[model samples]
Target: MTTTGAVLRIQLLGPVRAWRDGAETALGPPKQRAVLSLLASRPGDVMGVENIVDAVWGSDVPRTAVNGVHTYVAGLRRALEPGRAGRSSGAVLTSESGGYCLRVDPADVDVTLFHRALHAARRSRGQGEAGAALRLYGQALSYWRGEALSAVPGPFATMERDRLRDLRLTVVEEWAADMLAAGHHAELVTELPAAVSEEPLREKLRWLLILALYRSGRRAHALWLYEETRDLLARELGIEPGADLRTLHEHILTGHPELLAPGAGSPLPVYPGGLPPGTPGPVRLPPVGRDFVGRTEELARLEEVMRGESARGGPTTPVVVVGGTAGVGKTALVLQLAHRLVDRFPDGQLYADLRGADPERGPASAAHALEQLLGGLGVDGARVPADSAARTALYRSLLRGRRVLVVLDDAHSAEQVRPLIPRGPSGVLATSRRYLGELAARDGARLETVGPLTAREGTRLLAMLSGRRLDERGPAAERLVALCGGLPLPLRVVAQWLAANPGAPLGALLEQHPALRTRFGPAEAADGVPTGQFHVIETS
Candidate 1:
């Protein structure tokens, strides 16, 4: 953990340690440190007792191992959160069925921060944000103090040490690649020699160093280093230089114009985060189904509101909230609308899974969501303000004067999405199970409720999922819709069940999947329809 003002900071990138209010708290013996490191390795996940035991003691079963793990966790909890009292839920560590979890935020763990920064840097570099990529990559590489998990004793810590070191080297290599593309040949000429000496046979660094040297007008020295690498490989591994290094050597000899500029004048035209360049790159909207059924009126209404008018399309509205219960297909409708209207917003598109009501991760904090949004817009993670207020300001500044579409999906509340809303001509489309009344009242967000798909739409979806023409599907399709209560998720599941069994009737297919059958089974009139599962509907 980097620790600007966080209440607690834990570091596993170098050693197992804790700090609170500028003081290092004592973590007991080797076993206790190993347990904390293992739990921190999977922050927020419940590490099963058996898994922790295997990590700590290996296959040697001690009768006291489980009891020992319990004792260590008790000690860790006390040290991690001293404010919490006896028999109460500790803020840092908590017990769950059959095991325990260290419920610390990823921002408070150096390991998690490194991984996040490295991935974002890769994405930024992919999108031709050379300067932004370098900053992110540099921030990611800053977390390595020494060998990871150096103070913790166990197979898990030992393995993690090697893995983290290897990861750091890879990030360094990637950073070199970006630097070369950005015309940093002279800088590399100075920075790469020590790294080469440390890992003499790492071909990527060698290739990069050779290119950097050649580009820096040191042809004689570059040729000498190539021979040096070749000799090292031949001496240690008894193999010739691989094709990549050889190709680079040839390119340097011939003065390939490709090496003249960053990204080889081949800035990945694609938007960062995998959205194709011409489309809204930030939007997380899923692919729309080709056989998407109705919602004709609903789609029109959404498009109209997004255009800043009523259904008539006149005035300027900055936000649109699509509200629906579990399986009314609000997300699908919004995604389809975004894809349809993407060309209108030439600036970009942004999407976020707010994880509202998520069973595993719970509701995502707005600050975390904003960081992702900011990164996608070419802001460095380290440069992202630590406070939510400043982060929100920066996000809005990036979106100002640009016409973009921001989709906040599965939002838990207006407060979560409030800071994320665009304050410009760039419009937003948000989906939630609740109506988000505050948005309508405070932000002038137009709300549209998505109801269960009409029976016809559900029938069409079933036939499409089953790989049969809608007209050719059996009469049982309508009956299946009744069984599904016109909900798209369960109906889609039933369609898969049918596709799996050739010539199987829909009713017969239900028998094969007891769980799906339980949910999709015809409901008694007196018992009423089940409220259904919000978690599965949103997540699945």
Candidate 2:
């Protein structure tokens, strides 16, 4: 799906609505609205005729179903963009191969906007911006006029209704928690009773409601609410209030000042995922090495992949695969690039080492990696499934609207990082020693080979590491760079040795390591190019 035309606003979260130039443009009939919903649910992805038919008409498809779908597309194109000539290709909804796909900015869809706002709120909360986070969370929740896809009835609507409602409930609880952190206890005291009544089993909501009531000088009401929750749980599931809830009840009974703390400062409800209660920790990008240097082109490629064709819809999920031999600085380069892209992925950054090249341990299973990632995203450990496929599906669902940066280091195969790749504006930077041919050929990964650095780049790296410029020792530094074979890791090691042995000469250090002297003798070897892995093409 591709569009470089006028703005198109399509709302599907609550009711099926389309707007052009801030005016509500009519979207034909029920079938047409269903088609639009199905396509817009997954923008930029082609939906086949059968899937569309199934979603629109279920098993009771008409004999003229194929023709009917074509008619609907034609009608939608005209309704979406009325000026197009007869039989002209649409800029918004394009037909390809077997079916059609909707091309629209994710921000235009209420579902995507809601999710983006939700993540923004989470981030704001993390940064101690409870007021901003509360506003954002409230803006996200406000998108729901009622049950999502409420007006649109079909199998797809039924499926989405349950998913969106659950999400809405979670958002409601999250908003209440943020309000509690922002110290708007009185407001929550008024807002949460009805919500608590709706889902009596939701202990955290009831807890927040109790906290609110207590802080608002309603101690009797707070105790009664807790007792009410305890009785409800016992009556419904034959269990008492959780330990945390019980503890909170006692704290309220004692009139602890801590109970009245800002929602941001209040302890979060414990989730099984080892996350910090409500908010997951900040982007977990490992510290970039101090001595890391010189991957200008590779770093450019990372930026290119992250923002690549966002306007044109170039790659639904852009992936940059950096492949090279051991100690080629692939991981270091990826870390550097990931740190640089922090603002791009505000949802947070995720890193997982596949252990593909570890001698002691085998390559990490995709399922295990998913468990870590899901946990990092604040998913409960018990909530994360055991099956790899299910884990992948859940991971994708979590990543759908959020802009997360995933760094998969030492990946063995494309399959290892495949499920981890975030679709839409999110990106993945995967590094491996082996050339993952399938990634480029089948998975559309932009492959870049990280090779040895130049003689000058190597010298600069050594100087950067040693905390002193080596320009005065130019020829000596050049020889040392050549001697160390321009490989970043070994060169850094050589620099560290030089730093420790202050009195030892640069030449003397190389003379001690015979391998350095041997490789220095051969021009090709000094550049660190293996015979077969990389071929240097030259024309005279």
Q: Identify the candidate with maximal lDDT.
A: 1
Tens digits of per-residue lDDT for model 1, 449-512: 7766777888889888887733424567776776667777777776776777767655565454
Model 2, range 60-128, lDDT digits (tens) per residue? 878998888889899999889888777877778888888898888877888888889999999998998
The C-alpha RMSD of each candidate to the native structure, in angstroms, is 26.3, 24.4
Please provide TM-scores, in order, for all candidate models, with all chains considered together.
Answer: 0.45, 0.46
Query: Looking at candidate 1, what is the lDDT of residue 449?
Result: 73
> Model 2 segments beyond 4 Å from truth?
1-282, 309-315, 467-473, 517-540
lDDT of each prediction vs. the true structure?
A: 0.74, 0.74
Clashing pairs in 2: 180-263, 181-262, 181-263, 181-264, 182-263
- Minimum summed lDDT over a 10-residue window in model 2 is located at 531-540
